[model samples]
Target: MVEFDLVAPRSADEAFAALRAAAPDGAAVLAGGTDLLPDVDEGRQRPRVVVSLRHLPWRTLDWAGPSLTIGSTLPLRALEQDPDLVRRFPGLAEAIRDVGSVALRHRATLGGNVVRAAPTSDLVPVLLALDAEVEIVGPRGTRRLPVDRFVRASRRVDLGPEELVRAVWFPEARPSAYRWQRVRPANDISQVAVAAACSPADRRWRIAVGGVAPRPVRIPSAAEALGAGAPTAAAVARAARAAADAVAFPTDRRASADYRRHLVATLVERVVDAVVRAEGFPR
Candidate 1:
């Protein structure tokens, strides 16, 4: 690993100042360091300075009115095991559970996962399906963006160089399901992943897909079809096919473009089926 200076700020103010004063050579924020550390060790990243956010105080999960607010530095394992959180957002819980392994989850933060902006991130699609929003703080101030829009592309996000992700807020809980396909059964990045959520109050279905595009994508067409009327197996299949066709998967070492497309359709079908059944809607 390249030699670098580490700055640990005890508070958000200190962290902000450190970010503003970051050297011209460049600086990278460190949350759990589950991803950043690996890149540094692999020589893929060699920032002159690393700002560690682990010392910041925002590491608790709470309910703010009707919405669920998750601290940016909270461990993924915390969310995966929280009974209340699991009951409120089963899809999100499942996604977090599938991220890496028990040991990794203990060190991985939701904010880091979102900010890393990996196309294969397990939580991105599920958060998009839930219409989650992220709170960002920078030299300017705080601003919010939908989870779907936060990630611009692979390893890219909307955050500025001096910005820090504060927390993620979910409007409310809804019936949802998440599924992913991987090359192996052990802890591995997903080749294709799909998440589906149904808002019975509005009779709307939301769908998001990952690992088949440059970034996670929401499938409005598929959501429309499955939510148009009473969901049926035939309708779900048609919608899944449409979604599969919509994504242009790039050929990667883990899977071919054609195989990724196939996985998209199959996973979408499974997610829709699971969501519909869980919502007590006939199919």
Candidate 2:
């Protein structure tokens, strides 16, 4: 392991200062360290300093009417266990459960996932489907960006040197579902994943997929194919087809490009159908 200084800031201001101070040499912000530590161990990252957010007061989950704000440091298990999360954002809840195992979920955090911006992240596709926004705090001030804009590419994000993710904001509750095809049933990465949601306010559908290169993304064509409200079986099939053709799937050790394309098509239909049925939409 590379030698690095570790600092746990008690306040947001101090955290910012610690980051700014360590900027010249390279610094890493640690939430739960589930991702960061592994990267460090593998020599993927060698920061001069590791700023820990453990002492910060950011482990929060709040609901205001239809909106939800999740503190960046909050554990994935906390989200999975939230009584209303499964009902209001079923897709998000399902993604949380899919992260790893119960033990890993206890330490894995939403902010870390977003910050790492892994191409195969199970949460990102659902966040895209939900139109989630990332709340960032830095030396300048706090700012927010849509998750779509926040995540730029694989293992990359739009975070500034001194910035840290404060929370993720979901503007409204939606009827949604998440599904994935993995090599193993438990503690394995997904070969392909799909998240589908129907906005309650606009009655429009949204579809997002993972396991693509660069980043997870919303498939507008697929979503449009679903039309408004409950989609017919034919429409769902069309959407699935559209999704299957949407992204350029990469052939990796886990699966072939053709297999991923097939999985996306199949999972898209299942997720959309799940949202429609589970949410009691008129079929």
Q: Name the top TM-score candidate.
A: 2
Residues 62-170, model 2: lDDT tens digits = 9999999999999999999998988888889989999989999899999999999989899999999999999999989999999999999999899999899999999
Which stretches in model 2 have alpha-carbon errors above 4 Å? 280-283
* Tens digit per residue, CA lDDT, model 1, 128-176: 9999999998768899999888989888899887889999999977778
Candidate 2, lDDT over the whole model: 0.92
| Per-model TM-score on C-alpha atoms | 0.95, 0.98
Clashing pairs in 1: none
Local distance difference test, per candidate? 0.86, 0.92
